[model samples]
Target: MSNPPELPEFPSPFNFINNVPITLVELRMRNFSGQIREKPRWWEKVHDADIVAKWRSEIIEQDEKVVEQFWGGEKRFDDGNGEKKWPREKITGAQLDYIFDELKDLAQAIDHETGIQRTAIDKVYQSKTLIPADLKTVFLSGVSILESVPPEEQDWHPGANDQVLDLVHPSLHCFRIGRSPVLIPERTSGCPDPLFVLTEEQYLEMREDAEGAIVSQFISTNYQWLPTDFEVSQPGRRLYSNITSILQRFLPLFERVLSDSSDPPPPLAVAANPGGWYEDEESESDLSDDEMDARWRKFHWPVIHDPAPFSPPTQEGRTPLSLNGRKLQVIIKLANIVLTPERPKYPGGSWHVEGMVNEEIVATGIYYYASDNISESKLAFRAAVGDGTDEAGVSWNYEQSDDRGWTVAFGLRQWRSMNQELGSIMATEDKSSLGRGRYSAFSLSTRRGPSSRRATFPAATIVVPRRAGKVPALRALPQEIWDMIMQYALAGTVSLEEAKQDRLALMEERSHFVIEHNREIFEVEFNMCEH
Candidate 1:
């Protein structure tokens, strides 16, 4: 074979990856001058001093029998000094409130003979928007699509080393444009519109007809007519409907994130000379080298201030995200991790985003529908930050030489890649049972935004296949001729086996691209002296 064509280079570092142009926002570095938005700690929300004081006063005013009845019993404790203390003084405000809330909820559930709400359980750890108990049945039905496939037919996640089984992964058989071997186009010109999205009913019907097949006949045969006359399969019909229901529940949360990300909080005003410990030049001149160094370190390395409280605008205040009448391109994935006596623990997953640039996924929603006998797992998130060299609109009025102080104020470290830890979400498990598994479903939504260079589909008429007996013209054709016609019709598309290999290759290429890109953006050291 002759030498392969050389890959063209682009001006930007994050231009083309795996032959697809990356979105600018995909790896966009954030400035560090703004107030960090973080979820409040459990204590902060529930343990307000004023609220606690009012609760204590109320409890003290009540009679002993009334207090006992309200609290389910006499909640008294002996202090170290041997003084008897009621729960008002002994228990924290948060603890007392949580107890009362739980008692009230339990009483209501018992009276109505209904199951306790998942929100009550989640409140113990202050987790919000969890998959409620009632909705979990629908989510679990979507997860049950995995059972239809045989053990041998199941496809394990490519980079996960057989640890993760992809029951309905979009990466396996994603919609493709252009020719074989290179499904993704190099440029957006002449590419089909990537905006056509499947309706919930259409998506479900397609999956239902596929019968657990990885490749859909409708899409393969009508590759040129995708997003119009094509069908894609994943998780069966029931699973698709259930996933739609589950996604509806998470729409508000997704909308909130989208809203917040688009319009971030403003930065807090930095004081001219914060901490008030910097010495004048005359005082510094009098100090010895060791004393000066100590002073610099103290001024530079005072404890990094806590992030500001995250309080986004309420739904009524903000403009509503209208998704009605709009078709959505959704990628569904159901995953389960089983733990037995032999394998008691799971090591968790590597740091990675949802999809490659080709997928153009904007928002990802994960629902932990089932977790039994598993340890408390959490999904941590981090983002790339700017190197602070060219932070516009920020001017530190402190001493010019205090480079370290600026780094500390920005919550960044010198001589390190600027990657900020953006907290994690708890995927709490039930430790009541043993040797069970955890099941979760992921729904990733992709849209064709202005910045997106993803490919779309061309409008075309669908050629519906008819039964052999129903089509007299087809029935009259010889077996060999009919086979030739079928082959010619599918000549534009690759086989299921070829598609699987291509998916693996694409995943591997994307993985390497992400690793190298992350290294370039986040692993390089920052030197203050050079600046």
Candidate 2:
């Protein structure tokens, strides 16, 4: 083998992952720089077991006393003539009004910026859009306050039963739900917040409720701290009104954020290309007929096809694989092909190759031989006999077959599954040509044979029809598609059985998706290793 090309320089350790300084904004929010160490308590230093035990007992007693007085003490306000029971500190109508005012000021500040001053605001807005809308919808479903009284648990606020907040995601800087309800009894904190002490039965019921209930619930029966407007027999109208007013103030913000990001980019297309190495035009001339045969045998002899040490080089200019001047049998697996329709017009195509591997699928795809005599290597593709629908399928067995659909050249690599061109075609919707073929296009296999072999069809020979729209074709292969191809290449060729064992081993490994940004590109990465 020849000396390999020099690898690209690795990026520096402190290099910015991307141009965005959003990381700085996130770090600032955490305020790690301002964190202070706490002084250790006297009990922490007391090694004497008896003394430590006494301190713990005393602390527990004091905590109990505090809880009792906060709940039971009748702290009264001395009015000029009479004493009235002091109301517990719960979210009141006035507090709601204050919250709205504060939020209004923030929104106004966000909208007031111009030119350079708007940079921070724009970054924040862009960051907000990164979160998914379905996730926001889930959070905005709001909270349910469940009240557990002795053996029975009921919703504390009845209005919550029928109300869906339709509020913005808390992460969008709209507003955050305050302290979560704690699972303990305390003097200052109680039921109005949906704060709760869960009983075994209530916990089980909550587990059953799950996502089906739509809203989150916290159960506690301490209704004494509830707002004055809450009559024991009725829904807390005043408290509901306050919450309604506060959420109403945030409606415009949510509307603006959602509207600005209404249309999202289409999902990335991903596939496992079971094909072998993709070579370029530059490498073919160097090999003699005997040398080529040896190389082919080396590549295909392994039970699991491994495609390492080579890839379709972007610099050398990739070309289609040549079939050594021989008319070879091409078996196309309908299951390996991707199609546009959701409820596909043709179903059960996968059964054609239910128990086979990539090597078994011939005519996986046809390719131009990258020379003047392109026609000899190019195989004729036609609609397979018998199958009449626009669905992708072709006959692998000729004697037992009749009609089929159009076939296209699949991949330049031995594994046609990695062909991005084919993927794009599969992803596209075809335009009706008034029953006339205007140009040329590719297609997948169709129609099952009586035997176990997957349906086969010739690719690359059909005259494609004219496409409907002016959708701009991709100028360069997307990084995502390229990376996926590389991953398949590195994984080498492994048969289904080898793949199963490796998957089991992977189950025991720690893995996570790592994302890295390169200027305009975001690369999502995962390792496919065989341990």
Q: Which residue window of length 10 is worst by lDDT in model 2?
A: 429-438
Q: Write the per-residue lDDT of candidate 2 for residues 96-157, one digit (tens) a residue.
A: 23322323233334332210011112111111122234433332232122121232322111
* Tens digit per residue, CA lDDT, model 1, 1-531: 543232121112222111111111111111110001112222232245674455446443442343253233322211112111112122233433433343333334221122112222111111233445665665456555654568888776666544455555555554444342221122223534312233334433533333322212112211221111113256456655655675565444444433433342333212223234234444667889998876654443323222223233234544434344434444555555544444344566555544433333345555545555444455555544453232211222334334444333343334555444433444533111100012232211222222111000000111111111110122344575546545543555667687687677666665675576556543444343422
TM-score of 1: 0.52
Q: In each prediction, how many residue pairs overlap at the backbone (N, C-alpha, C within less than 3 A)? A: 2, 34
Top candidate, metric TM-score: 1
CA lDDT for candidate 2: 0.22
Worst 10 residues of 1 by lDDT: 453-462
The residue ranges of model 1 lying beyond 4 angstroms of the native Cα positions read 1-135, 180-235, 269-287, 290-318, 387-403, 429-489, 529-531
Shift of residue 477 alpha carbon in model 1, Å: 24
RMSD of 1: 17.8
Error of 1 at 243 (Å): 1.2
| Regions of candidate 2 where Cα sits further than 4 Å from its true position | 1-145, 148-151, 154-235, 261-281, 286-531
Give the TM-scores of the predictions, in the order they appear.
Answer: 0.52, 0.16
